[model samples]
Target: MQIVHSPLHLRHDGGMELHRGALVPCYEMPARAEYIREALVEAGHALVVPRDFDPEALLAVHDADFVAFLRTAHARWREDGRDGFMLPSGFPARGLRRDRVPSGISGAMGYYAFDAGTPIVEGTWDAAFAAAQCAMTAAALVAEGERSAYALCRPPGHHAGRSVYGGYCFLNNAALAAQQLRERGFGKVALFDVDYHHGNGTQDIFWERDDVLFVSIHGTPETEYPYFLGYADERGAGAGEGFTLNLPLPRGTGWDTYDAALDTALQRIADFGADALVVSLGVDIYEGDPISAFKLGAERFPQLGARLASLGLPTVLVQEGGYAVREIGTNVAGVLGAFGACR
Candidate 1:
């Protein structure tokens, strides 16, 4: 499998994040991708830097205004004479007027963000755009008939929505890859997000489109980080009515339980008869993950890959959340190795 990557991912080095009521060093660090890159190199997989694509590639899935805000957010913060990372102090959630756009940087931050977890560093836009390019490049490889490809995206997406950014995510990488595949002539695509947290942003982007089916198996929203969504009852709406599937598992879930949900998700993809598959591969479900509740063991990671390989579709594995820095490399390698070996 070809691994798509870029050094520009290191640009987004936000030092801190607001989590669990305290300001902590950001868990989504650059080393995460470095570790995975090391593992891929050791396993004899070749890494390729992605070429720059037009912003319209991103505009295909994200709102143009939101993309513009990300590109200028740091500059705006600097213009306002701020010193640290740019973070949203509030959100226009629930009954608020989200229609009108704000002119000031602070108000724009609140208007466009969903939470404070995603802080914008000086290189945030560059890193996020590069990561999206990595995903798109991998998707193009799959479109060109490569069996599968891997995109080691940092500032892990699946959290950023069409017009909102949070959860350490600025752009929805996996969603963009799926959209790229659709643009490349794939009639149907399946996005299976196996992150510990729900891919709220991905679901939001494709929730109304039948061309791409989105399935997420995550911690139940009632007790997870993203508390507003990820319920099993949240099927899609309008033309997307039955195209979305959510399998929200309880905390402390392990392979025995997770395997079942994954099987169900894979079955849905098979039934949908999609032309390609995109896996939002997040190793955060590992038992040692500091911020997550799943109990999946190291040995079980390969099984996750094997199951996905059973589908036999052109796949793009986009990197997402995995906070246990030490084991993140091994766990991610496990999935990719097994998937490639199975093929």
Candidate 2:
């Protein structure tokens, strides 16, 4: 498999995040992608630099105003005389008026952000844009007839929404890839998110469309982060009814339990008869992860990849969340290598 990545991701380096009621080092650091890229290279996979893509690709899955905000947020924060990275102090929740975008950078941060964990630094926009480009380039390869490709995106997406950015994600890279496949004439595309956290942002982006089917298997919302959506009852609305499938597992879930959920998700995609597949490949489910709570061992990732390969569809694997910095590369490369062997 060809792995698409960019050194530009190094630009969005270090920052602090609000976690567990205290300021902590951001788990979503630049090392995540670097490690994965190095592993793919060591495994003899060709690393391809992402091609530049137009902003319209982003607009297909994200709001235009939100994109503009991401592009200028850091500059605005700098102009406002802020010294450190920008994090939202408050959110426009409950009774607050969210109909209007706030004028101040602080209020705007809250307006566009769903949580305080994602900080805005000077290189955020460029890094995020390049990540999206990596995803798009991988999707283009699959669309043009490659069997499968990997997009090693950093500042991982899947938690971001159309107008809101949070959970260490600024742009929804997986959603952009699925949309690109659709535009490239794939009659139907299936996006399967195997992240430990539910891909709430991806679900939100494709919630109203039937052409793209979204399926996710994650920790139950009652016990996990991003505790708003991801319930089994959140079926798509309107024309998208029954197009979404959420398999919420509990904490301490092991390989046996996860494999059952994966079977169900894979069956759903097979029934959908999708022409292309987008896997939001997240390795955070590993037992060693810091913030996540699933119990899949490093050895199980190859089985996960082989199962996905059983579908026999053109696939684009877009990198998502995984905080076990040291083992992340080996875990991810295991999946990709297994998938390549099966294919």
Candidate 3:
């Protein structure tokens, strides 16, 4: 398997986030992707040549203003005489009478972010952009007929939405790859987000589109970090009718429950007959992950890869959340190794 990565990802360190009612060290640090890269290298996976994933490709899915805001938010924040990482504070949340966006940097942060958990550091835009390059590079490989490639992306992207950013993700890497395939002439693509938390961002991006199908299996939103969306009934809209599928499960789910959910999602992709597949690979489903509530153990990951391989579609694996730093590499490597065997 080819692994796509870039050193620029390390630039996005030293950010802070609001956690448990107080600002804390950000868990979605640069090391998350680096560790995966190191493990892949150690496991003997070939690191592929990274493509020049330009900004124009990003324009396909994200709003221009939102992209411009991210590129300039740090400097704009500095222009206001504050130099800390940007994190949102206020919201026009439930029962609020207005939907208009607030003005100023802080207000803008709140408007652009879905939560305070993801903080934007001075180097966030550069690193996140590189992370997209990582994903797009791997994706292009698969598009060119490679069976599988791994995008070792940091600032994992399952949480970012079309016009908003959160959960340590600034750009939706998996979604970006899916759209890239569509632009490159693939009639259909499927994004299977098997993260511990629901891929609210990916779902939102393609929620009303039919060209790319979005399927997610995650801890139910009723009690997850996202806290909304990801219901069983969000089966797409308009031309996208029946293209989106959400398999939200209760907490304490283990390998057996997750496997069943994956089975159903795979069957959906089969019915859709997608030309390519993007897996939002998040090992945070590991039993020991700090923030998640699943009981899947390390040894079960190889089976996860095997199951994904069963689909027999060209696949791009984009690294996502996996906070149990110690066991993370093992779990990720296990999946990749299993997939490698299938090929």
Candidate 2 structure quality by residue, lDDT tens digits, 216-287: 999999989889999999999999999999999999999999999988999999999999999999999999
Query: lDDT tens digits, residues 1-343, model 1?
Result: 9999999989988888889789999999999999988988998999998867999889888999899999998899999898778878877778988889779999999998888778898999999999999999999999998999999998899998998888999999999999999999999999999999999999999989999999999999999978888999989999999999999999999888998998899999999999899999999999999999999999988999999999999999999999999899999999999999999
| lDDT, candidate 3, 1-343, per-residue tens | 8888888888888567787577788877766776777788899887865688679788888888789888989898999899877777787688873466665888888888878888787888988998898888888888888889898888788788888898888999999888877877788999999898888999889989998999988899888878788999999888888999999988999888888998899999999999989999999999999889999988889999999999988899999999988778889999999988987
* TM of each candidate vs. truth: 0.98, 0.99, 0.96
Residue 177 in candidate 1 has what lDDT?
Answer: 95
The alpha-carbon deviation from the true structure for residue 225 of candidate 2, after best TM-score superposition, in angstroms, is 0.8
Top candidate on TM-score is: 2
- For each candidate, what is the lDDT? 0.92, 0.93, 0.86
Q: Model 1, stretches more than 4 Å misplaced?
A: none
Q: Show model 2 residue runs off by greater than 4 Å.
A: none
RMSD of each: 0.9, 0.7, 1.4
lDDT of 2: 0.93
The pairs that clash in candidate 2 are none
Which pairs of residues collide in candidate 1? none
- For model 3, name the residue pairs that clash: none
